[model samples]
Target chain A: MTITILFFWLSLAGTAVFAVSGALQALRNDMDIVGVSFIACVTGVGGGTMRDLLLGATPVAWVNDPTDIIVCVTFAGLTVVANKQIIGRRLDLLLWADAVGMALFAVLGAAKAQQYGAHPLTVILFGAMSATFGGIVRDVICNEIPVLFRKEIYITAALIGGVTLLLLPVGLDDAFKLSIAVVVSFTVRACSIVYGWSLPKYG
Target chain B: MTITILFFWLSLAGTAVFAVSGALQALRNDMDIVGVSFIACVTGVGGGTMRDLLLGATPVAWVNDPTDIIVCVTFAGLTVVANKQIIGRRLDLLLWADAVGMALFAVLGAAKAQQYGAHPLTVILFGAMSATFGGIVRDVICNEIPVLFRKEIYITAALIGGVTLLLLPVGLDDAFKLSIAVVVSFTVRACSIVYGWSLPKYG
Candidate 1:
């Protein structure tokens, strides 16, 4: 179906963005090329892998296909090669790309979880997990507390996007649902990036 | 059927050892009780969770059955409550318990991966994954470099045990094979602790 193809493209794009974001984090931590590649690969597939495992989808998507790994390595390699040129633009680009990846993944993850009959709350959590777990893994590996547990507006955007996906009216086509979710999530993330928005921390 | 019961006990014991080891590591980082519990839970289930996910076992064991979580919490809580009393013997106890965990998980993980028909080499790696991943995750969350990747006898011990599990001759009973693997791994670890052995590190 056309919906499948659209989701395929969205997943690929989201994966690439996540890979690049991970490589950027590696650079920040002064990890070498191998470190960059590993982080990128983990970041790209980590969320989906977790989602699939939690959903009990066997042979995990990436392990069965290997294409996702290939995509991750390619993007990470590109980041390593372009390291010198990306410094000044790195922070800005990283946030934008992370937001894009989060939007796409949040939608896709929620959809997959729903298809698997996850509780609505679980589906929303899956969306957030898919969008942000890679970053958490990356930060943890690099000895930084996970950004997700920090005061960022990070998980909020994913949760909102997931809820939006679930609330699609009965008659809306899948394509319409997907695009609207991506846009709404991306916009929220962008606003957060631009305005330094964050959730309040409890003492 | 007999083998199932044996492995059930092995898995529980391994899970407990991993939990205790994680709580000890959390203590080293000056984490509070909640932090200890969290780290212990992650360490206890992290490897099996990864194994099940990688093997496509749905609902991951812990999620479907809260027993593992309960065990992890109970052990962690005990560690917290007994903090003052156990410190003197912790070093010796930690090493021995960790060895037991690594031994059991390595055997179980390799066997499971083999059951799924993973290549021999991949099975060996899976065993190592089962043994050391929890510690790696534990250290990462604690903002420390993983001990497995350092100049420790840690991963080497797991790798050896995994390979031993794989190379068992065709006729050995499963129980005998499991015991040998665990013993071989524990002995190697014990020697390392007694002799201060470590793998050579590259600059």
Candidate 2:
């Protein structure tokens, strides 16, 4: 019961962060409010929606919980309303927040897949997907190549976090495992941003 | 053997038409050659890839057939080289060609799903998905709201075609059924475009 509560909060935070990122991107592209809202919704919940559909989970996350939509919509609206002020002053902070959200979502995805009896490899893939797919959809909607193809070690960080959770002791509590996973992913991504770490490029 | 060959030709033609649509979209967006090729590949093959992954079809379509990649790349390159001269004043023709491609792909998708022993409804959904997913991805990459959302008749046409194929008598040759399905979908879409037919809008 407690674990479920924690997960709900984590997911909410993740959604908020992703919504902001989407809104930011839309603003950068000079899209209207409707476009901003659309992008935010896609980035905030697109991955989990796909995962649920593919996994045959019923009542989909957002459909079951209207708060998910409200949260995303509110975040998007706020971001758009404050576009200039936010972009000029808090770009770095927003980036860090986005990283944290990615980490949380990645861990949550792995946990959900584990609950559904996915194998280790499948769980890892699901985690990476949950962390990255929203961003991919965002990029595609913004008419840009997916950052996954040519950006920071985004999916790699999620992969590491997922694998770490899988490798953790079986006796550990779910909350503990999830916390460790999120920490690992967040640290990796934050350091990558701070130190200019990136994956090797191949032509 | 003959049936398989026919299906192959239909799929190939569908792929080529889809590639042309993608290439033209990229040209309109003023993308470079590499970007055009990438968009063409995604728009031409993205639907089948999604279907295969969801259905757990091993090796996927293009992965199994190296020639598929060759065909896609060649078409993409050719389009880039000749777009200016060929597409200068033929936007309407391109739309019609895209409708044709959509119809063919939808029928092929229904056939493939039936081959996999899916339920009738599931088969119909797969057919629509296979026909439209590429275009959706293309729109996403081009930073446009997907035509699927705005064009209600598009998916309906695929659905109607799929149902017709499934309901047809089993004794009919596969080619005959396929031809009927394609013509039905094409006619529906063509008429829809010409007459500005659309699904009832909800306020």
Pick by lDDT: which candidate is best?
A: 1
Q: Which lDDT tens digits does candidate 2 get at residues B1-203?
A: 58899988998888888887888788888899999888888888887776676566656878768666676778889888887687774356457757987899899988987887776755775677688788888887787656654443677787777888998999999999999999999899888888877754211
Tell me the spans in candidate 1 whose CA falls farther than 4 Å from its real position: A117-122, A149-152, A167-169, A197-203, B1-45, B57-132, B140-145, B148-203
* Prediction 2: B-chain TM-score: 0.92
RMSD of 1: 6.3
Task: List the global CA lDDT of all models.
Answer: 0.81, 0.78
**Cα lDDT tens digits for candidate 1, B105-201:** 9888888877777767567667877887787788777776765433346666776787888888969998888889888887877787788777542
What is candidate 2's lDDT per residue for A86-128, written digit by digit as tens? 7675456557656887898888898889989999899999988
- Displacement of the residue A52 alpha carbon in candidate 1, Å: 2.4
Q: How displaced is residue B51 in candidate 1, in Å?
A: 0.8
Share of true Cα-Cα contacts across chains kept by each model: 0.31, 0.04
Q: For model 1 chain B, where is the 10-residue window of minimal lDDT? A: B146-155
